[model samples]
Target: MPERVSRQLVYLVYGGKVEYHQEAKYSILSALHHAQGACPRILLYTDEPAQFIGWPVDVITLDDQILRAWTGPATYLHRRKAAAIRDALQYAEQSIFIDTDTFFLASPVKLFERLAKAPWLVDEIEGVWKEYEGDELHTVLAPYLAEQHGIDQRMLLINSGVLGFQGDASQLMDETLNLIDIMHPMVPKIHIIEQFAVSVAARHLGRPAESRGVIKHYFSGKNYWRHMVAAFFLRHGESFSAQAIEAVREVPTDKPRPVWWHRLNFRLRSVFLSSRMRSHAKLAYYATVLCADPYAKACGQGYAQELRRKAIPEGESLSIQPWSRVLTRQQKQRLAKLLGESATGHIP
Candidate 1:
């Protein structure tokens, strides 16, 4: 049979952070491997070019204008994501934006297929009321809804973390950027930057958005708290109560699976085995050695370990250690020279 035509392209926005980047690469590779022929190409938008060398996907750099305006750590991430979407609009048939922190547990082609029936934004939680339970949450959104959007106080807030846009849709890019520009002054509350703006724009445009299958906000909820406690036990071992791990482990994975928890557990396992233990060795040694790689063959990439081995060269210095050990005085001087500043003036 002929290969299925790829109707959607996915992009992940990332900074140069080691852990997130490694996970991002793994996410993309895993997505591609599992969704083979289901997704055409996966693009990574990053400031660091060295990170994408051996990956099967394409890597694009953020333009200087976007980089300079990258006011907050991951706040810049959304801007880069919007820019990449606009860029991809020129070539792709359809597109979706996923955060670097996300992992694809199943083929997301159904998401793209849904867009053909209607142009919509993916809903995170059920509705606005569910998103805001009380005054505390309402206060955070008052400024955007009352002042900028002129909407009733009861509107639902949508998350922009995982979004799909139809390529043929008109002004989608323009409207998205305009919303971002409007939210620029609200930098202190940058955590809600993209979501608030996107929610407002969808309301204003009267555009309908859909939720991807069984989505869960991993960072929230009692179940997540339990999993976090379990991860802590896995990383901290006997230092953390074994009861917590057993409690979480016994919580019955047989229940309906949560979308985001699978990814979160995958990440916790990766860091627990890799670097989290190295930093707090005493707390983690027993646990790290005891736990199996939860994500070992979970990613669907038969060659995840092999790909990592090739991408990260043998003996390549890591940035996690102290500055002195990673770089020599002359090397620091050379870096300063390239940055066009004195070595002493630069902050480590």
Candidate 2:
């Protein structure tokens, strides 16, 4: 086997939110967990460096001016990701920038190995451009893209949740930034334009590889994961230690999947409820029934409350009476029992 090249695991955490910084910390811990004694140089580029005071990583402090400049003329937020990758390249032979929402399932050495062959690592190939031509993302700009950027059926639509490349791929990052600048204003509503740029630019180099097997990006189920991450910090505190690293293994790496009976029960009970209420019902189900584990149940309860808050109209007093009105007497009692309520009236 060829000797491995020096690599750095890079993360970008701005906005100075505690939740987001904590999420990035979990991801970093997961990498360290799977490092198996071969940990890379971990680099964190953030506006708030104080959040990771005790963490074993290089903190590249980013100020507002640099962030604004990286955003460029279009003021596209995601443009910073490309620019961040470009800056991180100077620190190592290969830079693997993983989003804060991701967790490692395998040793990151596998990621570097893939980069050795493919040179680019993206979250996943969602589909070809033609498959989504008529979707909300492309409805406004498909024709223009086809004419201007040669976007077609063969053009890949990639998820940029985990983006990586070697130092030699600086030109690819530059082209990605150029594509972002050119496309952002025209397709501002298309949130993944930066991802599209990465896909297209890397396509020009060669087919970019997917990293799903090595890491899990919970972008689709972000709220659930966020609640779980927050609960983790609340439980163990934010300090990074050997004990904290061991504690990370106790947090569930994936959300619990609802069983067939649980799904059927939720559908039957919530059929009469409005779409908004039914959504909360699923969360309630996860909290009370599916997530018997203490940590996940805590997250599920948080999600249930969050959904319930959103369901209420503005200026109205928050109460469970509205949620209970749609339920039959027997159904209310049943739901109350399932949710561990002492009485049917307590169903909330």
Candidate 3:
């Protein structure tokens, strides 16, 4: 028999939506495919384990009861993310918690090495939330966080997507739970609670956790990547053959280089967007182009045909999967405008 994995694991949680579960599948595939050093055991906590059939991962069935307890009195669902860190404590002494949208661009072993220096590793998305403290929309966890934890430095507000715990996570988890139980009731925005909790717990434990971009956090490009990934998996299924990995590697991490015509057209039409809008407009534009990328389009089309052959019920479509929608011209324009409005500084 093959040797069993007893220590050092990777944990991920995917529940509720099929699209999210599907996304998790690709994320895990990317991790396993690119991992270097001693590949740790992968543990997926979800109600659906069969989704990852042949993929070399251990599935921990997460029933509704567990979710309810994880949510507890908190009405919002984000609490479950922090609760998940608590869950990891029971299984592995050292673990890397990966979010569905994240991919291991390099060996995650380096992450464990960093974790050895500290108890936690945080994802640096927007630098520190402290930078956005003046903006109420961005600083959702501040005042309440201050009330609960006595106003610690708000320098490292991180995305909860990539978390690494080197030692016993019980203490951090307990403090995090206490922080959530109090703050969730005090402040209504539970979305940032998980990442905020991780930041707070990390602060309480040790020094600042720096981010060197070990994992490619596709936080903004997920919508496009989803379509690209779905097509890859639809063609390959659970198998991680070398060709499949190589094919996925083609799914661009950055925006496709724009042709001179596209850039020239943007310059001429730059009047409508502000400085911030220009940056977001560019991102939105690129994301739109990538959403309908030729490879993804072909894969998506093939998957749809495959589904149609199986006979989807009336009123229901074979293309019911998430991230399946092609970006309409008008819709893409509106998203660019919206992103621009949300943007604070110049993007150049």
Candidate 4:
């Protein structure tokens, strides 16, 4: 008999309001399901345990203080996610850290395999450093990074949304955390926190030796929004986005499965629909669906009460593109009904 090959484990770290619990659960589940043959174990780390449903997978909870120590409010819940990755180093031989907002279009196991063949794998967002006027943020954070953390200015600009690392590489994790610690105090921009940490580490640590490692940064264009939509459908099902429901309904089941990026575009359409502020009725319905449970409760009844205040008068047709035109007839119907219900004040 042939010996079974060991499977690589993947970890997803997230911390945020419980209202997004369903979204987070669905995102991980979709990745697990889609990458069934690729990853062996999938672990989730969070700050609030109550937000998650029971699962056979491993779950680790941490205190807010530990989270704050690594990342401040600038990144909000994402700060805790970074801290979770640091904690995950004690276990597993290799792991991939994914943000909850990300959805898998296909098995990313090959990406890891590719990374294993290379040195490192990280993602780079479009126009990251270009936004920084001069290197003020980079320069100010550089000294603290070098003097205290030993990272250079050039390396302080990578995104941490998706990171692949060898489980045995504890040194990399330590260097990453140290950089996070040094940069956190000097930089207040929460969005750049994770990227800044990774960039610095990569630059300071030097590309891992061919035997040590290589780093490949993945870049995606505006099309990435489509992945978010696909993730929303897999999680919220028919509840969250009417457009996603329509898109899924229209897909030919026999056709080769849609790529992750295409599904992402479907989801992006929903976001665009929800943003049509002119459709007060549609806006209220989407808000009710998107708000999740406690989030709505927390905002009280007034959260969406104003939706009807500026509702488009009955019988007045809005100029927005209809879901049916964008998707199949069946999908269009489902979405139209949901939108109609929302406009009619039946959602709450």
Candidate 5:
């Protein structure tokens, strides 16, 4: 065994949404399954403690008032992430926070090792500020960040899926919280202000080592992973048991993507479709043909609902021409069934 390193693993889960609770539960299970010899102390800060009743971890329950205060006066919700991690410092000298929508590809001891040396570990380095100068996010905020905060070509934009640091990072957390409060008001609707703030703070603290190889964050393909996780719970049971712990090993860490030829065939079929129509068509294909399990079918239904919202304006009739042009009769029938509509003219 590698030399033992004392650390605390932290998570934040709020809300009663089943999908989110399920994600957190499965994420914890993934961590436990990958922990090789000595395991780090696991701390979960959640509003709904009942959701994790049988899990082997310390639970810090939060009330609405506490949660509201963490978001701060700006009502910038993601600021709560930094605050939650900072609170974990009281429990251990070193702390690592990972998002619920993630799974372990290797033991977290690797991350703890990096954390000991560098004192900063973010999920990934997205890119530098200058690369996205003209995009929607950077076009408006980049100049201000560059001129005011000295954000330049070297300043990175990191994904906050996994964050690791030592308890002495109170100053880092304070500065990150401050940055979040200041930047959020400028782009009130943008979702990534919290992530950028952490990057700046970590850069100030020390060089950041990335955990991409050891941890897999599935935020982009959450729907598929959600289905897979739900399936795991269904096969076993939701309650914690040695059997369930062992069974977690059977769950694949990544979503299985289509082969290249399959992707090419899909692209060729969608060549004549409008971009929006093509996107809807891919959802339909994924639902009906890609996978046969009911979980996959359920995911397909979600995709269908999303397509309906985007393709059909409220109080307007569904448009059949776009789908009709792309889908064959059988595929339309399958998609219609997923949407709970008849195959005649209801497919979106």
Candidate 6:
């Protein structure tokens, strides 16, 4: 018989909010089934391991004592995400720490293969940390980065939701941890410090992370996407482990197919709201826009509406296209029913 080859990829997941828990289940289910020729192990680090009792993942129960020892008394909650990646270094040669709010559209074998050919892989390659006048981090951390590393800032910004590495990227993880240690004293909470840290280390590694849209982030559009998942669970909402998994395979993620009307609408919206406000104003404006969709926004689920702020007159990219029509009457009605709204669509 031909010798069997060892698997080349490992799917690493972590975290423990109710939303985090549900999405983690969705992420693992999607990843394992879609992996083409490899059946990689899925390692989950969570405080509530029992919640995933029967799921096909190796659960490492992360209790308080272990966390304190690992991170050394830091109260920053998100620091654990980076720490998880650092710890995952021991288990596999190739590992990806995926965010809970993501789902795989296809096998990650190609992605792992790509990582083998590069220093690191990030979900989306972006310019958020560059020398742009609007980049907030440039003003805050650039001096420290310049003084220490002889670089103004990490050039290749990335959406760190899906962080993949082929070898011991401990230097990268240490950089991330160091960034958090330095910045935690200044900021109320160190949000997204890991991305910047990884960018710094990736720069040291001397390559840009490849942009592979293999996994779709329902992150911005999750309010609507959450409704679809809830609908799928139907009566199975009670137990995530025993819930039917196949229907989650059908959540509609197709970007609004471009149409002439959509282009015109995009143009009109651009002309009307086109002035590029400073980043603060843009964030404030997006927060207000989110209010237009009340149900999911309040619970902190939807934020995709902000895409309209970046829309333009001539761009064909769906990334800048607002949902145009978020929901038809029928779709809203279904969501209403899911939320236990009445026939008249009134919430009590």
Best by TM-score: 5
TM-score of each: 0.55, 0.84, 0.72, 0.54, 0.85, 0.68
Tens-digit lDDT track of model 3 for 37-87:
356777777767677677667777778888888886865677777777677
Task: Please tell me which model should have the higher lDDT, number 1 or number 6.
Answer: 6
- Candidate 5, residues 239-263: lDDT per residue as tens digits? 9877776777777564554457767
Candidate 1 lDDT tens digits, 91-198? 566666665544454465656666666556564624663356455446555666577658675565666667766545336665666767655554545556566656
Clashing pairs in 3: none
Ranking by lDDT: 5, 2, 3, 6, 1, 4
Where is model 3 poorest over a 10-residue stretch in terms of lDDT?
317-326
Where is model 4 poorest over a 10-residue stretch in terms of lDDT? 209-218
* lDDT of candidate model 2 versus the reference: 0.76
Candidate 1 wrong stretches, greater than 4 Å: 1-6, 63-65, 69-77, 129-148, 167-170, 204-348
Of the candidates numbered 1 and 3, which has the greater lDDT value?
3
Instruction: Identify the superior model by lDDT, candidate 1 or candidate 5.
Output: 5
Candidates' C-alpha lDDT: 0.47, 0.76, 0.60, 0.47, 0.76, 0.57
Residue 337, candidate 4: how far off, in angstroms? 12
Give the per-residue lDDT digits (tens) of candidate 6, residues 231-338: 444434635452345544554444322345643544454453434433322322232233322332332222222322343233243222233223334533433333
Task: Kindly indicate the candidate among 5 and 6 with the higher TM-score.
Answer: 5
TM-score of 3: 0.72
Name the runs in model 6 displaced over 4 angstroms.
1-16, 69-74, 132-135, 235-245, 255-348
Give the per-residue Cα lDDT of candidate 1 at 69: 62
